[model samples]
Target: MSRARRLTASTTAYILIPILAAVSPLLVLPAITANHGASAWASVAIGQSIGTALATVVELGWGLNGPQRVARTSEKASLRWLTLSLQTKVIALIPASAVAAVAAAFLAPSDSLTSSLVACAMTASALTATWFFLGKGTPWLILATDGLPRLVCLALSAIFLVMGAPLMTYPVLGLLLPSALAPCLALYIAAKRAPLGTKLWWRARAVISALKLQSTALFARAASAVYIALPITLVSIASPSSVAAFAAGERLMRMGLAAVAVVPNAMQAWVGAPADRQSKWSRAKRAMAANAALGFISATIFGLAAPWAVTWVFSGVVTLDPISVWLFALAIFTICTSRGTGGIGLVALTRVRAIAVSAAAGACVGIPAILLGSAWGGVPGAVAGEILAELTVLSVQVVAIRRRLAAS
Candidate 1:
């Protein structure tokens, strides 16, 4: 394939994977709400949100670290690094999954079984070498290994929803099963491609140390969880109906964000490649501009269409306040713009510490916003808080990028 064609295929695949993942849940939510109502839908959302946190834990820093390492490592060392990363993730998964399971049992006792299942699936999915494929700029491999199972599971979830099965089953099958299967599929494909360095598992601890050597990205991700999952956690405690509505809006916002992310994803190599500071800054600025434009466009569309979209999707069984929908959309836009300008740009510049500081600033803002917002106004307040948090983070990042580029 021509280089251009290859890039197109890779970007297309990256975009499709997240869309496919969202489609299953999006399609099922209407049914879930229609049959079981908002409360039940809320349960599933809470389960998935907790699962997301656990997945982040099992991922450690690999999602950020592995891709860069893969880009720089030689073919001979690639297998070793892959093996090492997987082992470290597995080591982390045991404890993290255990904690998630226990937390599920205690906090969501009504659906603990399904919550635990989803957690396990997330942990398994975390083991998949997605970063390797991303770094190699071969997104099609991810589509096959990750996206295909997601589709299969989506079909199954729809079938179960039609059969009037429990709401929890939808996420377990549609979300969790595919995730659990991804690592196995990745391994099968890797085995066919070349010999994997399985023997490196013994050096897992050292590998983990290497992974943590530059863990600013990990800290950033950890800190961002305040805005990412804390709201759902709080809403789950405040009101089940609100959780359902928030989840729906948040889901759509993420779909839009994922759609907007394709360009940035495709530009990672160019941005991260070894280059003079001026050249890197110029490319980064252009990429950030494109990303922010995409975000604005997505937010506008989301705000305009969200009411009709929500009503149609859930059969009017669940509806969020228009303000909440708008806030959620704004949050998505700010997140996309911040990540593009700050997250990806800093990684490319190797100014990862700035990323951590930016995330910390967001977290400091988010914790209070989420807590007070949920306490004050329920879902809308929580979302409004998130909006503030993301904007704060973005401001810090944009300033950091400017100073770093100017200093260099």
Candidate 2:
């Protein structure tokens, strides 16, 4: 197949996976939010927030570098690499999930068990085959192994919730099961397909070497996730009621982030392919432009429709302040753009270290803003912090892109 045609097909297929299957969690949320009390709802959000952030830590930044690494290797080599990545992530997961559970329990003391379970489940998603499939240019693996499980579980979770199942059922069926299962399934496939020798995947030397090499990406992706995810957790520290109001908006924004990821993700293989400097820059320009248009649309729709969406989804149990919603919407726009500039742009050019520096710069600005803002002005203030962080990452990336051009 021609390169352009292949990319177009791959992009369309990737986009469809999210549209058809991966959006299930969003569809199930109304049932969860309407049935649960506001505190329980907020507590669940806290777990997801902390869990997602720690999951990134467990992933060890492999998602940032794995696709490109695999794109350049043989199928057997790629499988072996995935095994190495998984072992390191497993080591990280032990510590990360523990921290998430502790923080989730402290924040949601009223609903500690469910909250901690949610946190642990989301953390376990570090094992997903997302990066491996993307590198192989096979979006179907995502649907078959990862998306389908999450979709089925989400449906079951919704039904169980409507029938008055305990709150823990959602996290278990909807999150924990799928999150851990996908990687196990991936590893099983790897074991069957790859001519992997008898070397132990759990060896300390291999895990430590992988960790050292990927440390920059680990720190970078983790730092960036802080601004994107942890705001609700931070808000919970101030007022549980405020968290409900903020959680709806945050959930909407997060779901939007998930939906829009197909763009940069689909483009990753294309951008990260071996190319001349100028051609690489051109690919990134097209990616950033496409993401900008999508970001604008996402922001406009989110800002205009969020008030009603939250009202209906929460069954009027949670009402949002407009200022907070719009700010979060703006953060959504910046984040989408940054995903192009930073997620694809920096990583594609083999500028992984630059991404780490930008992420650190963003976290330095974002975390404190969230910490102080949530305590001071509530959700709106916290969202403003996220916006600042996203913009900082974008600015640093644009500068890097420009420098790449000049040097070329």
lDDT for each candidate structure: 0.71, 0.82
Model 1 over residues 11-111: C-alpha lDDT tens digits? 67877866765565566767777877765555566666666666666676566656656765555466666666667677777887777666554455356
Whose TM-score is greatest here?
A: 2
Off by over 4 Å in 1: 2-8, 194-201, 238-241, 274-278
lDDT of 2 by residue, 144-205 (tens): 78888788888999899989998899888888888878998887766666664734256678
Q: Tell me how many clashing residue pairs each candidate has.
A: 0, 0
Compared to the true structure, candidate 2 yields what TM-score? 0.93
Pairs that collide in candidate 2 are none
What is the Cα root-mean-square deviation between model 1 and the actual structure? 2.6
Off by over 4 Å in 2: 1-12, 20-22, 191-203
